[model samples]
Target: MLKNIFMLFISQGVNYLVPLILVPYLVRTLGAESYGEFNLALSIILYGCLFIDFGFNLYTTGEISKTENKEKIRHLYTVTIASKFLIFFPVALIIIFTVNNVSQFDNIKSVCYILIIQMLSSVISTVWLYQGLEKIRIYSLVNVVVKLLMLPMIFTLVRDTNDINILATIQSVSFLLSALLLITIAKRYDIYLVKINFSDIRSILSSASHIFTGTISVSLYTMSTPIILGLVNTAFEVGQFSATDKIRGAFISIFLILSNVIYPRINKLKVDNEFLAFRFIKKITMIQFFLGLTFATAIYYSAPYIVINYLGSEFQESIDLLRLMSPMVILVPLSVILSNYVLLTWNYKKYYLCVPLITCIFHFSYIIPLSHYYGAIGSGIGILITEFISFSLLLIFSLKSGMLRKIYES
Candidate 1:
C-alpha cells in the first residue's frame, strides 16, 4: 500500500507540476480571453468524457478487485471498453452538433472538435484496471513520462492565442500516447479485448446505471462550473475562475492519491473481514480529515502569495477566489471517505448515490443565479456550498442508514 501510494504520489506530482508550469505560460501567452476559450472547449468535451466513462472507473475498480477469475476480469475489461465506445459515438455526435449550433460555442467550435481526441483517449484509459490490480507502478510511470514529454512540445509550439489549436492538438496527442502505452502494458494483467455481445454490454451498463447517475450528479456542479459561467458570464471571468480552480484542483488531486490507493484495499478488506474494513475506515477518516484541514488552511492563508507568484497581476482576482475555494480541499476528502469508503464499501450504495443527487438538486438552483450576479467569485461560492452540502448530506445519510453507527458498534 505504501508502495502504491508513493508511486501514485510521483505520478500525481508530475501531473500537478506539468500544469503548474504549463498553465501559467498558456495564460500569459493566450491571454485570459483565449485561455478561457480553450478551457471552455475542454470543459464541454469533458461532458462527453463523462458519458464515455459512465462510472466505469469506480464500478470496474470495485468489481475487478473482488474477483480472481482471469476470464471474468477480461470479460469485464472488454465489456467496459465496448460499452464506452458504444456510448461514445452518440455522445460525440451530440457534442459536435451542440458546439456547432450553440451561440456560446461559436468562438471555440474548432477547438472543441480538436479536443475530441482527448475524449477518445479517455475511452481506452486503463488506470482503473491498474489501480484495481494494485499494480500501478508502470501505469504511473507512463503518466509521468507523457506529462514530461508534453512540457517541451507545449513550450516550443504554443506561442500565441492563434495557436489554440496547437495546444489542443498537443494535449490530445499526449493523451492518445499515454492511453496506448497503458493498453500495451496492461496486457500482462489479462486485459485483452474479447468478443462482447450486446447482452454483455447491456448488463454492464444496467449494473452501472446508479454509479453512472451518481457520477453525473457529481459533475452537475463540478464540471458544469466553467460551462455555466461561460453561458452566463464573460470569458475573462471564466479564465479567472479557471486559474483558481486549477490551483484548487491541483490540491484536490493530491488528496485523492490516498483515496485511490486505499479504495481497492478497503474493498478487499470488506470481502475478507468487514470488521477490519470498518476499522481501516475509522483510522483513515481521521487522518484524511486532519490532512485536509492542513491543506485548506494553507491554501486559505497563502492564497495571495500563490496568486501573485504563480498567476501574476492580471490574475489577481484568483486570490480571493482561491481563498473561497480552499475549504473544498477539506470537504472533498471527507466526502470521498463517506461515499466511497463508508457507503459504497458497506453496500449502502443508495445513500452513496443519494448524496450527490441531493447536492445537485440544490446546486443547480443557485449556481446559475450566483454565476449571473457575481461571475467568478459567485461560482466559487456555489462550488464551496455544493461541496459542503455534499459532505453534510453524505454524513447525514450514512448516519441515518446506520452505517456509521455500525462502524462504531462493531
Candidate 2:
C-alpha cells in the first residue's frame, strides 16, 4: 500500500506539474480571454472523459481486486472497452451538434472535436487495471512518460491563440500514444480483445450503473461550474475564475490521489473483516483532516500573493475567488470520505445520489441566480455551499446507515 501510495504520489506530482506549467504558459500565450475559453473547453471535454469512463475506474478496479481469474478479468476489460466505444459515438454527435449550435464555440470549435480523440485515448488506458492490482508502477510510469513527452511539444507548438487546434492535437496524440503503451503493457494480464459481446457489455454496465448514477450527479455539480461561469459572465471573468480554481483543484487532488490508494485496499479488506476497513478509514481521515486544514490556511492567506506575483496581474481578480475556494481544502476530503468511501462503496446509492443531487440543486440555484449579481465570486460561494451541504447530507445518511458507527466505534 505504501509503495502504491508513493508511486501514485509521483504520478500525481507529474499530473499536477504539467497543468501548473501549462496554465501560465497557456494563459500568457492565449491571452486571458482565450485561456478562459480553453479552460471551458477542457472542462466540457472532461465530462466527455467522465462519461466514457462511466465509473469503471472505481467499479472495475474493485472487481479486479476481488479476483485473479484471467478470463474474468479479460471479460471485464472487453465489456468496459466495448461499452466505452459504443458510447463515444453518440456523445461525439451531441458535442458536435452543441458546439455548432453555440456561436461562442466558434473560435475553438474545431479544437473541441479534436479533444474527443483524447477522451477515446483515455478509454483505452488501463491504469485502473494496475491500480486495483496494486501494481501502480506501470501506471505511474506511463503518465510520467506522457507528460515528459508532451512538455516540449506543448512549448514548441502552442505559440498563439490561433494555435488552439494545434495544442489540442498535440495533447490528443500524446494521450493516444500513452494509452496504446498502457494497452501493450496490459497484455501481460491476458486481457482478451476478441471475446466481447453485447450481453457482456450490458452486464458490466448493469453492475456499474449505480456508480454512474451517483457519478453523474457528482460530475454535474463539478463540471457545471465552468459552464455556468461562462454563461453568466465574460470570458475574462471565466479566465480569472479558472486560474484560481485550477490552483485549488491541484491542491485538492492530493487527497483524491490518497483515496485512489486506499479505496482498493479497503474493498479487499471489506471481503474478510470490515472492522479493518473502518479502522483504516478513521486513521486516514485524521491524516487527511490535518493535511486539508493546513493547505486551506496556506492558500487562504497567500491567495493575494499567488494571484498577483505568481500568476501576474492579469489574474488579479482571482484573489478573492481563490479565498472563496479555500474551504474546499477541508470540505473536499470530508465529502469524498463520506460520499465515496462510505456511501457508494456500501451500495447505498439512494443516499449517495441524494447528496450530490441535492447539492447540485442548491449549487445551481445559488450559482445561476447569484452569478447575475456577483459573477465568479458567486460561483465560488456556491461551491462552498455545496461542500457544506454534501458533508451534512453524507454525515446524516452515514449515521442512519450505521457506517458512521462502524468507523467511530470500531
Candidate 1, pairs of clashing residues: none
Question: Candidate 1 — what's its lDDT?
Answer: 0.90
> Pick by TM-score: which candidate is best?
1
Shift in Å, residue 37, candidate 1: 0.6
lDDT by residue (286-349, candidate 1, tens digit) is 8878988999999999999999888888998898999999889889988888888888777787
lDDT for model 2 comes to: 0.83
Q: Please tell me which predicted candidate would have the highest lDDT against the true structure.
A: 1
Could you tell me every candidate's TM-score relative to the true structure?
A: 0.98, 0.97
Question: Candidate 2: which stretches are off by over 4 Å?
Answer: none
